[model samples]
Target: MNIRKKVIFSFVILVAFIISISSLSMITTYHMKENSSFAKQVSRLINIQEDMNELINLVTIENSLEKLKNIKEKFISFENDFELLREDITKKDHKDLIDYILPNIRQNQNISKSLNNLFENEHAIELIFDDIYKFQNKHIYHNDLFSKIYPEENEKRKLLQELIFKTTNLKLIQEFGNLRYYSKETLYQHRDMETFQKWTNSIDEIILELRKNDRLKILPLFTGYKETVEIMGNLAINIHNIEKEEKILTTKLIKILKENRDESSSIEIKIEEVAEQFLSKISFIELILVITIILITIALTLYISSKLTSIIQKLNSGVKRLKDGDYSSTIVIKEDKEFSEIATTFNNMAQNIEEHQNTLEEKIKLRTNELQGALVNIQKQKDILENLSNKLAKYLSPQLFESIFSGKQDVQIESKRKYLTVFFSDIKGFTDITDSVETETLTEILNEYLDIMSTVAIKHGGTIDKYIGDSIMVFFGDPLSNGKAQDAISCMNMAIQMKEEMSKLRIKWQKDGISKPFHIRMGINSGYCTVGNFGSKNRLDYTIIGGVVNLASRLESNARPDQILISSETYTLIKDTIKCTKKEELQIKGIAHPIQTYEVISSGNNSTIIEEQTGFNLILDLNQIDKNNIINILKNTIIDVEKNI
Candidate 1:
């Protein structure tokens, strides 16, 4: 057969095997379910057996009407459980097994009812005996009282008490109570009828004695004594009759229980036999079918493998020749049309391989020139990237530069409104200090200050937006944000660290022969502001602008020397984390309202309150602070202020 027919035949055989396995599994499942049902019924039967035994026990321990009532309730529950099990039997074999057990269940129910009757009758007999005993005791008391009142007949009263004690059947109730029965067999063998009859005879003898003795009748209490004897004797006979009936009923109940026990045993045996028979039959067939399927599968596998291997070997041989550079010859297969087409394709591939070999040198030369051109372009791009990287490092933070270079952030002058923590700090009395320092020393001091502040900003993940002469502007929560609160906290921490570093720088500058050292003041604010690259097409500035930014600058301009001032917005975000004292409000320019500020005290160190209250408002045109000649102008202002005072 061709490959298609071979594959089809193999598939058909596999499908047949799967169907066989499925059919076997279904048959096994059916038998398993049948066995499970049988087991369930047996389990229920066992429970009923335990209940019956418990009933017998209840009767033994209690000889009262109440215990008998409890026995009826328990028996009803047992019947319900058995009925449920019977309804659960759905399989034919399981139903047949239950058919045998159900009859016994019914019989057991009847037996339980009969036992209940026996218990009731026993209770009634005990009650009557109790009443007779109580009456006998009352009569003896009256007799004694009569004898005491009439002293002449005291000896006769004593003899009457003896006769009464000897004839009473009160002690017979103890014998009835001793009728021990703990199981069905014990109940069956008990001599209850004989015991009741002997009790009746003893009472009859007492009644005969009472009738024959005339002396007993002549006593003053003779009528009462005779009435008591008659009542006791009658109750004894009634108990004896009831005893006979209870014995008969108990015997029948025991008979039914035994039959039920036997029937239960038979059903269990039948279930075992049925389960064993079904399993053995199914297992035998399963084994045979499995062996047959294995054999068929192996035969088909060998047949298909042989056919496929022949074509594969031919194709493999041609592949090996191609691998060995034999491009002049091709393989030809004749077994099947499919193999023939493969051979044809293989031959065409060999012709193409030969033609490709002829132009291989020219292709290599062309590829070499292309690779050289790519290398030259790569070198030029590398040089351009190096220059760009160096320039970016000076202008942007390493993180922001990487983001822009990696194409994650664009270089376009696009801006967006975001909440950022803006920081502004400047050297206190910078102009006054600059006047005492040389130009070169001042340049050195300024560069050192900028470098130190910038280092702290980058370390705290802040972006240094710009430097305005002796002032620095930095903001966080842009391009990447650790959240607004975190950014504000980080900015505050950076400001604290910069203050500490500046103290050391001041000491170094003083040691380098500078007489006056400048202290830094910082201001921070956290609020919504527009931040991005914004400028002309030729030049762009990545900075933030808004009222919030202005507020930060105003806080810096108004801050006391060596103090860090934060706007209310920044203080609100870091209030729980940073310790700060509220500062007086400042009326900032270009704003409608006076802004609330807080001086960050004891955040990291002792931040002094150096800016004193002037008691009078001193308004100065801040525009007079020139970028180029701020020191000379600031000195002139100090002289003019002294003159005004």
Candidate 2:
């Protein structure tokens, strides 16, 4: 696991150890309290039983009422002590202990009370019996004396003895409820009352037998003897009831003690089990804690020591190797830690030093080789430069080549919107001419024609843009220009000169075994166009683009062979310097409006079209035609036409 989980696990184990110890302690404490409580309650019960036994002894021995009262008071004290202890008992180790013990305590108290009542009833019976016995003895003594004085009274004395014998035998009657009450069986209904009434009738019968017509009936003590017997019968009934109640209470007390013993025994067993479990848990916790501490100590020590020592040793070895000039040696310590970073840095340092050494060696060798190769490379470059120079001169005008090579033109990729006179021309019917001419003758004628046109274009400072098969695209007013008027004039001059040159080339081609005539169409438009080195960085073309270029191409496409068409914009710029004829407005694609164009009839004092068509004989200042119409034109025209016609 990761460090976080390991730490949490360690913390959990420690907490569990503490909890185990605490739980053992709590278990021990609870049992201790429970044992103390059970012992106290049992002791109270034993003490109560002992006190009750003492009270029973007193009833059987001294039978003193005061002694009985004191013994009963001691039992009450036991009950009070039990109550107080019950209050003190808070921990319920055996949750049902009170439920099990309380009724028993109550029963024991009832038994004590029953025993006390039994003693009282038995004592009263004894007193009554004693009085009856004493009265019987005195009557016997008087009977014996009277029997000696009159032998005939002996029958009455014998009857008296028999009656006394029967009355005394009443004590031998066993109670019916005694066996039933102890066994929790139902008692005969009203058994005590029945026994009481039967006992009272027996005493009445004995007294009646003594009172039958006899000479001894006149004795004054005989009435007291009868009253004593009646009292003794009542006392006997009370004694029997009390004895029956005592037996029941004794049974309940025994049952209570038995149940108390069982419950206490159960609680003791449970406490023993808890103690055993606590001990086992404590032992296990101790074992785990010991093992965990030992393992963790060893593990942490090894981890920290091995990590720190191994990484440091690797680093030290790397440093020693570096000192020994083994700069190429690398330190590799594989671990998921910061040591990996240190090793990486060490490796990089070693690599840098090694690279520095290798670089120094390489630089020395390169310097030597460069010196040796310089002469041969110089001669080789001279030949290559001469060939490139010839090729560049063939493709570019001297002015364009100078501008670029001298750094006057940077040749960066950029475009500018400028009003430039764009020129386009193509040889008409060159494909058919090529079809009719031999390849060698065709090449000679094409080259001768291009060379002538290029010379004329360069003379007028026109930039030769490119050649498309038999077509030529050139532009002026860039790289060098006097003004718009001058640039337009130069472009028109170039077009006219190229047309004149093509006329001579056509005648020359025919003379040199050529069959067909070659003609050229030229189109020129002056407007805003974007001009720049337009292409990828590796290969660029100094070119122009925009609607103006397209319009120029369209003008070229529309021009008849041997005709040079120019837009109105160019026409206006060089109208005074070059002559032109206004043609129909031509519709060109990509242009919103029709273009006003003119045919270049001639250039520079070549054209003359100043005659007016209207009939007139007035002295007209025709220079005003180049300016505006004179006001006398209408009157002169009417009279002169009428006279001259």
Candidate 3:
């Protein structure tokens, strides 16, 4: 059981035992007092009965009128006393006293009945008076009234003499008269010493006789008185015994009380002792509990402190490593649940930091590589720009491309002196070719032809200024500073070479079963011209602007395929280096006057030329020649060209 329950249970049992013992002790004490009071009352009633018996015996013996009066007076007093005693006994209300008094009253009534019987019977009265005289004389002594009778006592005797003289019948008087005289004499003597002695003896005889006749008659009163007295004595003894017993009981009670009190005191002391012991035990338990709690708290604190210190140390180490730029530290604390999670999180954070650090390095490397690649690309673009500048200078002039590309805060353009050769080429019957070809095929062919023509121009120290449909405007002698005359001759030679290359390519295509023929027309002009970048600020072009440039374009437009038409000035400069044929004076568009043109016949030591008529010329002459005649001429020309090669 728990301590509290145990204590409560013990306290309840102790209280129950005490109450049970106290109740039993109280009941025993009540019974003892009741029984003791009963015995005492019985004893007192018996003693009263004994006194009535003795007084009744004295009254019976003395029967003289005088003595009777005295006895009567005494009896009256005795009756009064008896009445008082009876009242006293009745008032007592004790069972033993009532028992003793009730029979005595009956006995006294019997005595009164005996006295009345004496008065009623003449012989009985005479016998009773005679017996009383003898009983008194035997038992009484000293002085007697009747024994010492004399002449002086005659007057007292005269009343008795007169009673004798007054007798009526002799025969009746014979049994009574002499007896009356003797009765009077005895009565007279009963007053004397001897007579009284004789009367006392005579009363004793009567009493003895009465006792002899019905012993139990007196016994009822005597026995009742005796029994009452004995009972009273027994009661007294019992009361005394009770008192002794009460004394003993009181002593025992006192002893018991003392014992109980001592026991109670002991119990109280024991209770106090037990309480003290319990308190001590409780205090010890509390101390133990406090100590245990303190220890547990201390242990918990130490454990937490150790864990916190360890965690903090690890965190500090991690922080130090992180400060030193090492993002690879891991926390491995295995403490409490929360701390474990924190450690795990710390490890995860470290891992994340390390991963991020690696990712940052990779990103930095990638960004650096991208920047380097961009720089390399920019450098390549710069090189390309430089090359483009050089090419543009060749066509327009160095000053022109520079002015266009340079980011000068302020820019001004002035004409510079330079000898330049400008060339312009156009495809013959290009409109017809475009109309016959698909748009995609036409663009493809145009880009291919332009790419080839531009390559040829550039190869010969020429620059392509622009492309105008199936035409190209080329220039020389500026970016690459060769002799203008030589540049013109070189341009002319490239144009002729281009025509011959195309014719051979066409022949190869014909042999390979291609039906379409490709062709180009070119015009070259050499002159003194202004070359630079020229335009508004936002827009510009690097080109030659002069009459010679326009005249060169017009000549190229009028030339036939496989023809290199040069201006008169260009022919004058390159006539010695390249072969040319005088072509025609052509009225050109956007020109105020006609200009002399020539066909570049051949390059040095390779005097080969395709047909002078372009595809446009052939188409124009289509109505003049039959299809069969044209086919026959083409076949014959192919045979002749093959034999010469």
Candidate 4:
């Protein structure tokens, strides 16, 4: 019986020991899970808090009172979440856990209160902005009404003064006063009070001005209205402060509740002690059983850990190789059936990765080649364009090229030299011809004439300097070698050619049933002159300069169709090559001295001179000449020219 009782007691003790070990293991696992859950919750709360803070900062930077109000509503919602978290903590069975979490909850509550206060302050400022807007409207209406009564009252002045007063007062009393008393004390302490004092002085000056204005008798009413508005602004700010303070108090209360909910240390300690007492009750029976169980458990644990560690080490090595861009590496563990399957999956994944990596590398290489080709083509195109621009520069005179390339709209060339020869030629009766011609035909005709003249000028070593409407300005030398005498002779020869060419052109026109006469005038002069690039830095032009150039133009103005006139110097130079007739010395406009002029009588070739009183004839008195005789002379001259041709 004694042996049987001892055996039964041993059996009971073994059962109790087994129960204790199992309970301890379960408890440890539960504690670990609980802690992990709490940590994740805290992390989530922190992220939410950070997001809220960023939103608040955005609203503050914008100074957007409307957005601030919206954010305030969101803050209220966040506060509710804080309240719920606090309540959740309070309801938790584990008080020890609550203690660990209370501080974070309390911090979140404080942040919410701070944001609420910021919103209230911004709202108060918005009220002041509203007052400024109303004042502006009032000033606008006042100015409009006043201007109608006094027509020249300078109502704008009054409006400006009122605007200054209102803005200064609002900035001082509303913006500076409230923000200074609060924001400055907290954030920026160095702001000067002198600014506010100056604002008040400015308001007094505005009042003095208003009193001086006899037409504005309602100054007292205006003053009273302004005072009331200021009072209202102050009252609004005060109420906002009170509300903010109330929110802060409420937040503090919530923080206290969170603290109460988080008192878990004592409970955790008691639980541990209870577990220890229960464990001690089975200590004697558990000693031998625990030794044997521990030996077996250790051996099983080491064996399993070794297997797991081997597989884990292989996976870690594979991951490292992947990080190093070795997609060919793979994990392989054959210790157990489960691990073998995992290894197989890992090897398959490595193969896929290797294939994908190769494809990606090939695609990258192709894309790089394409980009390189495009870059080469773009560079080649840029080079070609640069070459074209340089070639175009050769056709332009230096002054024109500088104006175009240097980004100027116009070019001017000025010269200090006293003497220059100038030539001006125009298609005679161009306006009358164009009146019956189509616009396209007219443009074509003008382009043809310009092309011919340009070719003639270039052939004679002359510069086709400029075109003014239907006229041409030609010079002997510019941006190249000087050929003044040679250019004059060549130009005379070109004029003779032009007259011959025009006769044929006229015949063609008549055959085509056109009735407009095509005649041209040629003028030449040589004297001291100036020339160079001239005008503002923004615009410049290259042309001959001086009184000599002007006189040449005057001589051109005096010439008639099919006629070429020259100054005395030009006549002397060309007398050996061409025939000429001396004309009487005549006084030209804007000239202090009279100039001797002559006509090119002939080209010493087949060219004939048509005498029709060519050039401005100052010798004949218009008042004394008979109109019928003049008409008869003109008719006879045309018949004579036709016969000569």
Candidate 5:
């Protein structure tokens, strides 16, 4: 278990132990008090039974009313005490004792009162006879004195009669609920009442006989006194009979008292034993509580502390491992309390972190591999594109190619009017020469001728637009431009170089055994023309088109072999840097009027010259050809030309 649960469980165990101890102690103590009270009551009841009996016996023997009066008070008090105690008793242990004893105490509560009644009867009988005895013993016998003293005796006897009536009446009420009266009718056939009737009849006969003996003057005072003495005697006998009946019942009462006493003693002993056992048990329980508390405290403390320390250490270790980047670390907990929950959460968190890290690492590795593959593929594609671009450069002008690839020009159907110098050149009678030669020889010668012309065109900063068969068109201006006049001059210079290169080719072709030589015609024009990509979206040609371009083609078509033609507009632009001669105003189809034209002769500074005679041409570039071989080559060229003719 975790620390919190261990502590709480320990506390609960301690509390339960404590409560058990307290509950047991309280129960034992309660029983002990009950048993203690029971024992005391048993002893007290025995004492009351003994003391009240002895006091009643003593009062009966003394026969003194004062003493009996005191005894009566005690009897009432003790009897009331017994009654209350009997009512208060609820224990089953003394059930027989209380049952036997309590009834006896109630039944005999009148014992002292019975004795007092006996004494009162005796006193009444004595008073009844006292006046007769005094009257008989009278010393002065004078008639007046005798009358006076005897009358006083009669008065005394009358008072004694009243005492008898009151005692007998009280006895009657005690026995039969108030039946005594001044009548001859007997309400009961009781023995004492019968004896009282007998005495009453005997005294009445003596009193009647004494009336004959009137000489007994005291007899006159004996009126109603006989009945008084008889009633007093009967009361005494009744009291004695009641005492005898009480005495007669006492043997059984004494036996019951003895049995009850034995029963009480047994109960008291049981109470004492129970109280002692409870007391000893309470002590034992206290000892057990202390020892159990100590054991539990030690056990729980060790268990909780060990568990707490170990779990904390494990948690701390986990934290340390995680902090050090050991994401694979985990913990094992067997307890299923709060700490187990925490450990589960922590384990889940750690597992998630580890899984996340693993997943992230795997993703990074996969992406890295993909990127490497992509780079390799991209490099391969780049190599293919570069090769394609190199091959494509041969078809497009370098200026247009560079501009488009360099992001300087947008490849779209767009054009602008730029004043450009345009040039067109073609072989003279190229079809007739082709029909005379073999196809392979013609092909080699045409390629050789076009290669020479293209080299000259590029070297002069002209963009080679396209070539149709043996014809070539070139232009200067955008995508790059110097000036309109400079463009025109550059074109003229390029044409002149072409003528010189042709002269050299003619000599080389003759040496290769060609029976015919090729001559080229060139045309130049300068004007505004639309120049840009011209075609559909999928395919485009970076070239020029307009009247200027058409005019250049026209000029080339009209020129003679080995001749250069120039429009007036182009001649004006190149006049300062080139040598041209006016030819004629040739009528062009698309023009409203005829246009002026010229023949290009040479550069303002001529670097070379090539001349045509009747059957041969002479070519020389003193600045280009080796000085030592020039004369021999010229004399050799003259012989070869004449031989060919």
Candidate 6:
């Protein structure tokens, strides 16, 4: 048969095995549950057996009517427990046991009720002693009065005294009290009818002797004594009867419990034996079925494995031939079984691969030459793009140019609020210089000066915003910053360096025959300003704007030539790193309040200008040396030099 039919047949057998195993498991589970339930019932019966034995003990040990009352409640509770037990006992053997135990339990309950009623009606056994004591006291009182009336030591008085201190009567009265019962146990201990008869006879003898004393008969106290003794005799006999009944019932209850215990043990053993036998049967059946399934599964696997091994070997031989460039090879299918379709498809694929091989080789040859030319063109385009990027860098500040090329900042018309230290500086007499000098010469000077200042600003990490005429605007704290304080300090240092550079340029210009060279005024301010690329998308300028920029420009206009002025905001930031003198507050345009200002001075690393020439050499740091002594010292040195010349 083909593989599909074989697989379908194998599935049918597996499903059959599954159904068989499941049915067996279900049956085993049902039987186990049955056995477990039977065990629980037996467990409950054993507990009832224990309770019944305990009830027998309660009846046997408890004889007092007061204690018997408590036992009466115990009897009721036991009855309740037994009734519940009876309902739960579904097993035939256990139910039979319950049937037997029920009648005996009822008998015990009746006995407890009888004991309770006996004490309730009879004022208990202590009343006998009380009656006897009252009779004895009356006899003593009357005997003494009779002896006083006669005043004679006679036989009659002697007999009356004999009755007063009667030993026989005292023994009868205190019998139960001496036994420490005086209640239910009084009758229990002396349960024999002979004991009651003895008590009665002793009372009869006392009355008989009292009748013999004619003088005592006339005494009212003597009559009362006789009647009291008679009442106690009756009370003792009645209490004895109640106690006898309790003992009989208790003995019967004990006998019944012993029988029930034996039955409980037998049932427990029988149930266990039955359970063991059932489990053994189930295990044996399951073992046989499991072995059958395993043997069948092994045979099925071997059949499929043998068929698969032969098919795979044949397919592998065909694949090896095809791999060795044997396109003419074809698989010869036998049995029309597994892998026949795969053999047909593999043959078709081999034919197609042979057909396309020549065309693929031709295409690869042509693509090789084409790819080389494209690579050369790609390299040329890359160099051209890099050169163009460098030219674009000239228009933007170095920081801004780097951000745009590095993909950190997007070139868009976007702006954000940032705290920047804005700087503005212009040549002191730029308009005069433009008119006095030739256009070519003036343009050269201006370019040279701008180049110097631009280098200083860029070196201090400022973004050169724009150059208006000879005026240059720059800002710090933009695309990147070392915080506001550092940005402000760097700007102040840049301004100071620019001022010093101007002094050097002045000397250079004098040598160039241009007597009055340019001086520059600079201003710096720190505050929140709008900074980013501003303008249309086609033409954008990465610069800053707002009131802080305007204030910086105003400070520059108000500054004196060769001076660097700054706002109070910038002063605070540069105070630690650079020396700045707080200046007078000035009211400027577009500002409601007076603007506080400061003059920039030397920094921590201030340098003195050292000028050396053919005729003069001057090295003076005004901040470091004594200025008052310098003028006379220079004069004396000049006079000595003049004599030598």
RMSD to true structure for each model, in Å: 35.5, 58.1, 76.4, 25.2, 67.6, 42.0
lDDT at 639, model 4: 100
What lDDT does each candidate get? Answer: 0.67, 0.64, 0.54, 0.57, 0.69, 0.68
Candidate 5 yields a Cα-based lDDT of: 0.69
Using Cα atoms with residue i matched to residue i, what is each candidate's TM-score against the true structure?
0.43, 0.36, 0.33, 0.34, 0.45, 0.50
The 10-residue segment of model 3 with minimum total lDDT is 228-237
What is the C-alpha local distance difference test score of candidate 3? Answer: 0.54
Tens-digit lDDT string for candidate 2 (505-565): 6666666867566778899999888887888888877888988888888899899988999
Can you rank all candidates by lDDT, best first? Answer: 5, 6, 1, 2, 4, 3
RMSD of 4: 25.2
RMSD score of candidate 6 (Å): 42.0
Compare candidates 1 and 3 on lDDT and give the better one. Answer: 1
Candidate 1: regions farther than 4 A off: 1-323, 326-355, 372-376, 379-383, 406-408, 604-645
- Error in Å for residue 581 of model 5: 2.5
Clashing pairs in 1: none
What TM value does model 2 have? 0.36
Cα lDDT of model 4 by residue, 1-645, tens digit: 333354455567667767877765563444445544544444444444444444443433333345555665675565556556545543543445533522222223433353344334334333433333333334334334433433222243244445444444543334334422432222123223343334334445445555654425435544544353333333333433433443453454344334332323333343345446544655666576798667766765576567667878888888888779787777777665666677778778878887888899999999999999999999999999899989977665544566567775334444457345678888778888888988987787677767776766666656667888778888764444346666567667766666555555555555665666677777888766676767777766666777767777777777777777788878876777778888778689888889898887666543232322223112233446787997798799889979999
Where is the poorest 10-residue window by lDDT in model 4?
Answer: 610-619
Q: Cα miss at 539, model 3 (Å)?
A: 2.0
In the predicted model 5, the residue pairs found to clash are none
At residue 375, give the lDDT of candidate 1: 100
Task: Output the lDDT of residue 538, model 5.
Answer: 98
lDDT of 6 at 17: 80
Ranking of candidates on TM-score, top first: 6, 5, 1, 2, 4, 3
